[model samples]
Target: MPSPDRSSDAVTPFHLNVPEEELDDLRDRLSRTRWPERETVSGWKQGVPLDRARALVAYWEDGYDWRRCEAALNGIGQFTTTIDGLNLHFLHRRSPEPDALPIVITHGWPGSVVEFMKVIGPLTDPVAHGGKAEDAFHVVCPSLPGYGFSQRPKEGWPVPRIASAWIALMKRLGYARFVAQGGDWGSAVTTAIGASGDPAVAGIHLNMLVVRPTAEDLADATDQEKASLESLQRYMQDGNGYSQQQATRPQTLGYGLVDSPVGQAMWIYEKFREWSDCGGEPENALSRDEMLDDIMLYWLTGTGASSGRLYWESFRAFGSDKVMVPTGYSMFPKEIFRASRRWAERQYPNIIHWNELERGGHFAAFEQPELFVEEVRTAFRTLRTS
Candidate 1:
């Protein structure tokens, strides 16, 4: 284990060991769930379907094995380090290849470090995963402050602060030069880090590119740009309710999420159905185990409120600045917001790679790990020369 940085606080090795009693309690709660009348409309229009919610809860109570998830996390080398008065939890898996590049992979709202579990092996130990040793990366996946195992911030810790903390984390780990990759809010933080003019941040890769266009930019938009704008507008109209609730009143929402396991599950599960490339059901995109494993991260840690608080801090604050570093973007077809190459280039002047992927959605890594790994590898391959 790496020793603590005495100047700040110790970088203590951490493990996942939720108590048996908590698991029992969760099961009991699921068993005693108070039912609500089914939605009048068909499908997921109103929310997670009543039948789907009940079925998922039943499996969560009887079939889910949190211990397996815990062991998998522990197996990947978990640790906590105090950064800016918060104990930040992260998975630090150094590549076996000495020359591998250091890269920090960040997750956004409704996601934890578990998002990168499948890609970790391929990135950190490429040879073991049927890749060349030269393609390896020292992968670091941190739970954003106030999410997962990380301690909640007493005050606001927005995207810029989170970016700074990430840089500090990389430096503390003896990485003088590193790259960053993220999607969703992770994209915001990575963009901030790239734009901060930190020489340590060699480059960044983003799956979600949030761009703001001026009136003139919108007036002369291409077909793709116009379509992208329309999609965003639709989302702002119909899909933004949860965002608005979380940003304005996360505390009120948290009560239900924290108190009812079914509530928390449905809150996230709805996003999986809506945001994923799964035609109608999220099961088409991720396995039942995969979805439940992610939910357990929130439920076990009781971070329902704290996790939603990130939106409160930075939801309305996207694309405030331009990123000048060598940047790469992978635009998944089903992402909530898609930026055309021209629009993206306006914001990211030094974009080296931009690809519109055919599959995947917001949770790119979790939904399509193989494609996600390829995208990451391809995005940073040239930057590795630095």
Candidate 2:
């Protein structure tokens, strides 16, 4: 791929530095990765199909340049701070305008602040690019706890705890009443942050919101609702195994993931490729570098295990009280599944807007930045003024 553009527009403005010894160690590990034999199966029907992962690993070792990726990231502005004992990392780009709205963005598992790289420019300097100043925001994108540059917590850090830390981070940055947006795991954190009702939070926007079936919907659901429910059921059957494990026995899995980079890559790559809008092959929707960049962030940071712990923390606290802040939901077409407006309304009483999009998936900001920015901008536009 062409050298990454080093414009101020880049959202992730930080480069990772693996110690000389660490790089050598990683290389040694890659060289020593054990190959696993597999029974013949039809396409990814039996999970990642072993051969594909081997090919990716071969390319990763022989072709991929970590230094180049590190430079690409460092080209943007970045910083780190201690929050609630965990060191938090973030990308902060101030808007050119004198009065830009402060908006904080969070990323989910398998994603770092890197997901917002495409939209940082537009969100921070809209007026300079023919967009209205009102659409501009001083974007604050944080690598969720135990992910990216952030240090992993020894104790469990659940969604509510994360949300609390984010609220505190914004306060430290002097954003008393900022807007918040997230996707996937981010959606959960942002929702909890909104629910905190910390006057500093103006509104919440999300690309992924899992609304549990309500008593009424379950009683008299339409065919579409039934289909949606089935989709959810199927997801739980096939997809939720990861969540169950993380919630219950994250430490057990973390031991293996933290040791092997290939193992860590496979664990996350499978989710990105499977849970995305990609047509079977992830390369169809995302470039190899793009996929690897995310994986590299987790691997280099050694955050695979710590990040997985969020699943356990959040799932344990899922059935608490509802979040009562002004909320907005962006309905992406191929996000594994989406909750209907009615379903979302049941959980978030203050939902002010529900947007249906023509594109995007679970990784909305990365997959469809324009759509992601528009939905977020529109959702919070009214709240910002009021």
Give the per-residue lDDT digits (tens) of candidate 2, residues 246-340. Answer: 88888899888889999988887788777777877877667777788888887787777788888877876652447788888888877867787
Which residue ranges in model 1 land beyond 4 Å of their true spot?
1-7
| Model 1, backbone clash pairs (residues 3+ apart or across chains), number | 0
Best by TM-score: 1
User: Any runs in candidate 2 off by more than 4 Å, and if so which?
Assistant: 1-15, 128-130, 319-321
lDDT of 2: 0.79
Model 2 clashing residue pairs (backbone): 13-76, 13-77, 14-74, 176-200, 177-200, 247-312
- Of candidate 2, the 10-residue stretch with the lowest lDDT total is 1-10
Model 1: lDDT equals 0.90
Score each candidate by Cα lDDT. 0.90, 0.79
TM-score for each predicted model, relative to the true structure: 0.97, 0.92
Model 1 / residue 305 / CA error / Å:
1.1
lDDT of 1 by residue, 188-225 (tens): 88888898899999999999998887788889998888
